[model samples]
Target: MDNWEEVHEKWTSFQNLDPSLKKELDHLAGDKKKLEDAFYKELTFGTGGLRGVLGPGINRMNIYTVRKAVNGLAQYLKENTVNVYDRGVAISYDSRYMSQEFALETAKVLGAYGIRSYVFDELHPTPALSFAVRNLGTAAGVMITASHNPPEYNGFKVYNEDGGQITPAEASEIITFIQQTENELTVPYLERSELDNKELLNWIGEEIDNAYLEELAQISRLDDDGIKREKDLPIVFTPLHGTALELVTKGLRQLNFTNVDVVKEQAAPDPEFSTVDSPNPEEHQAFTMAIEEGKKSNADVLIGTDPDADRLGVAAKDDAGKYRVLTGNQLGSLLLDYILSHSDKAILTNGRLIKTIVTSELGRKIAAKYGVETIDTLTGFKFIGEKIRQFDATGETFVFGYEESYGYLISSFARDKDAVQAAILACEMAYYWNKQGKTLHDALHDLFEKHGFYLEGMSSLTLKGKEGSEKIAAIMESIRKEPLAEIAGLKVLEVEDYLSGERTFPENGSVEKIKLPNENVVKYKLDNDCWVCLRPSGTEPKIKCYFGVCSSSNQESVETLESLKTEMENVMNQV
Candidate 1:
């Protein structure tokens, strides 16, 4: 079948395998299925780069695998990038297990090629790495993180000179060079001593951090009149045992929020993520510790960030005095409304609000209220970053960009989703509303009252390992084969099959081309302006179903969302 056995033999017999890794390989001696799954193929490296379980196999995220990927990037940059050595790559890592090791190994691989790399001394946010690329005028950047994945998982993401994730075309070229790397263990790299002697590996920290924070301070300040509005407002933050503690705390303090508190349990970087079952901020479970801290301190608001701090989750006390976690869409809507209502007219002129296709329509309506046009990109924040670059070229202001996955971008300083900037601004907004005797919950209600209650949610089925991958493919294929006409009595007006790059309108029997890049996704524009979309996760082994509904009242939106979700489940179950 494949060369898995051949690959396995090479890995096991390698002379200089890490001793711990060798032991792990030895433990797999009598396990055929585990071996097959681990060595069936090299880890998939797409636009998102490499992500997989941590272990010794070629398909896992071990030192050799990391080296192989870095070597491929080295080869690609040497060929395609201008001033390859002079315009070095910026590298940063998160709090995941072996993340620092992977970050150092990345520098060493590039060092072997005589390519310079500026490495952060400690763990940094993904967006900071993106900012460092442009700040240092580097040819590319690398961030070693799995985002919100489980403890045993780790990943590497690539960025272009524009400080955005590598575009699809660029990814295709890098994948070609990566495939050219035949032997993982044989890939050459400079040792730490060699790296130091060559002066190719450089350490970077505080200066870049200050630069990033200073840029954020320029925009995160909402009230400039030196007005006193609960400046000591109690705020609770938790990094969820990730990398956000230093930057986020400094950011809040910079905003003059003196009473900010950190959940002591999640204040330190934890590889095992001992505090929460899942490290993702989007989940309510991740807020347990932060909410507990909020209750003890009578905090006005709570903010929780994922491991890498690219995503932010928020909660605020409602009239009932209990904290309620805000959905990504709800928080996004609040941010949009606050920015538009407070910003000067000239800055708002020709402003653009960019959102992913799956984001709630409520933000669109909010932007329209301010006369700002809302544009939809694909699901990834990179697409939004690309739009920011495009708009800059055309002399339009990049107002704000966000997605439904708890990631938001305020300014163009950091091209990727920036939770640091968002946290500062969100805390300021919360404190400002608090002075008026209202919580963020009240601000959200004011938005809902004006722009109809928009409820959006996602459900994913986790299918792990190779079998899960196959099942995800089969499910998508089945949906394409037999398109749906209705879901729970709701009529489907149009079906968008992104794989085919075509949109079919069932009512008119017509088709149109979708302008976005090709992805394996399907969407339905149903009657009553409701919509549903399904796509296999690019970075995780899951198929996600996104549902959205807008109604005159909160109760109506909730009921319709439940109906839509149940009907979609029934439809997929049939498939």
Candidate 2:
């Protein structure tokens, strides 16, 4: 629909809706831009799942849209199940705007279909929700969080029985069902009170928290004795004002980390995330307060988690007496090395590591040294979680798993990324390293020397609104139509077009099938141990490009990265 027609339709529909929804619609009716933005299109739901600004509109995340999503999921479950309620669903939410309300709404919708739901009484981290699905033996799970997105945004992530995000094939089926529903308001739903009365909505809170914490505690490689000896090892932590506050602080106390400190300004959940422009831990702004606090406390390490506490970011004091934040790749490599180096040789003998192909290959090199097999999957923690499940079923040990975007999982107990668990492990790593009179920076440099120097960076081009989105699609099309045989001064050895499900070698004119499920991503491997990948953001209107380079020296690695980045920029500009 054209912009004006779409706006008019939404305005007319707003006048005809129920009183509550009509009130919300009226609030935006007078503003032409607001109306246009709200009615541009229905919110897109792909493999990364649903995300949008929370408001009342077809393009916004609101009660009607959420119910429509749940209705689709309900129908999918009913049609595919022999006993609908037997395969129940677990529901959890973070501290985002309307997150709790959305969680209850989801349960109510499930209850309307007579599908039982176990809903957390209060906000919980995303990883806990993933764990609950498997621990409670539910068929699926839903987490109401936007991860590190801005406060205006909210999202819904669907997970399968194995506690991983829904696979592409399953997500496509659900999306079909969602689109088939014409009137979102017509989707059935029960009131939260009514669902509770029917015993279809079960409130699960502290009991589950205790159980989850117990399992997390068991995964600790450090004992009370070790923690006691290193209790004074200074550590700083920040939750970025989302669900990890209580769990992470309590977990640290339980581990006997006496010198641990939480950033006071961001310790409480604030829906606005008032202190920072963006709550994403990967961005330096999110850690501004935490780093300042660390400097004052003279903390040896600084750690932060996003709003939902799924992804983790770390910073540490280098030998130069300056604080430096480590990329997800660097942190993952450190954790992988520490875990393997500290683990029993017997466990290491049968262990395996998993990471996304977009993640830095440094972890694989470390795993290789430990004799641990490394497996690569497509980007997304769900793929890593799926591999963990597969390994568990096949009796293969899962040593570690991570993605370069600050997501990591060490134990199978929590099926998704657990910043709480990561906080504990990071503190423990600091404690042991401190006892050895070394810092994380020193350890990182040592690893870099042992393995080849690996440097990686990411650039995202956000194309907001209708015009921007069309431009993004055009750029991807251009790249596909005119494939590059060389980037910078390096010859392209292979081009993996995930969307086409084929890998091509330009020099030899050879092509091979790609076994992974199809996705709209293209990766290029260069002869100089450098690689680049391009893929559009699933939940946002942005195109992301990833660059990875390896060299014998840090200077060479940085120079190569700079050259490739220039070339990639030129390609982007041309489009």
> lDDT: which candidate is best?
1
Assess candidate 1 and give its lDDT.
Answer: 0.90
Model 2: weakest 10-residue lDDT segment is: 7-16
Q: After superposition, how far is residue 312 of candidate 2 from its true place, in Å?
A: 0.5
lDDT of 2 by residue, 315-432 (tens): 9889887788889999999999999998998988889999998999899999999999998888888788878878867888998999998999988888888888887898788777
lDDT of 1 by residue, 1-575 (tens): 35889888988888898999999989999899999899998899978699999998988999988998999899999998899898899999999999999999999999999999999999999989999999999999999999999999999999999999988888999999888888889899989999899899899979999998888778754656543333788999999999988889887777777898999999999999998999998989999988888989999999999999999999999889999999999999989888888888788779999999899999999999898999989899989988898986798888899999999998888899999888988998897798789999998898889888889988888888899998889889989998989886689999999889999999889999999889999999887779999999999989999999888999988888999899887766666
Best by TM-score: 1
The per-residue C-alpha lDDT of model 2 at residue 551 equals: 95
Q: What lDDT would each prediction earn against the true structure?
A: 0.90, 0.86
Clashing residue pairs in candidate 1 (N, C-alpha, C atoms within 3 angstroms):
none
Error of 1 at 541 (Å): 0.8
Could you give me the TM-score of model 2 versus the true structure? 0.96
